[model samples]
Target: MTVLKAADELEEIVARVGPTAARLLTRGEEETMPEIAEALGMTEKAARARPTHYEHLDS
Candidate 1:
């Protein structure tokens, strides 16, 4: 499998998923890495590690 460690790879993902979803929105329980990877043209692991896994830090 290919790794998306490079800036371009990450950028491609961000472009496809939108900045809010890509850089902020977290994946739901039903969502899997493979789904995102395929959409972003990245590897499952890479997509899983994406910053899209967002969480609310404040109450």
Candidate 2:
């Protein structure tokens, strides 16, 4: 998906889950995406496949 779409999705997730979603996105741990997805109740595929999707969270 495009960065725009990813950002939108990330924004929505953040809206639902609050700052923890952004914190997970910026985390430097191994398997961070999967951890973030699991924390947010999303599928691992949706998180791991598109790292840039959460760029807005970093900003």
Model 2 scores what on Cα lDDT? 0.62
Residue 32, candidate 2: how far off, in angstroms?
2.7
The superposed Cα distance between candidate 2 and the true structure at residue 19, in angstroms, equals: 13
Q: Write the per-residue lDDT of candidate 2 for residues 1-59, one digit (tens) a residue.
A: 69999999986876556545445555674557666778868887766544555444445
Which candidate has the top score in TM-score? Answer: 1
lDDT of 1 by residue, 1-59 (tens): 25545777876665665645644435362365567678889987777666534222121
Query: Which pairs in model 2 have colliding backbones?
Result: none
TM-score of each: 0.37, 0.32
Find the candidate with the highest lDDT and give its number. 2
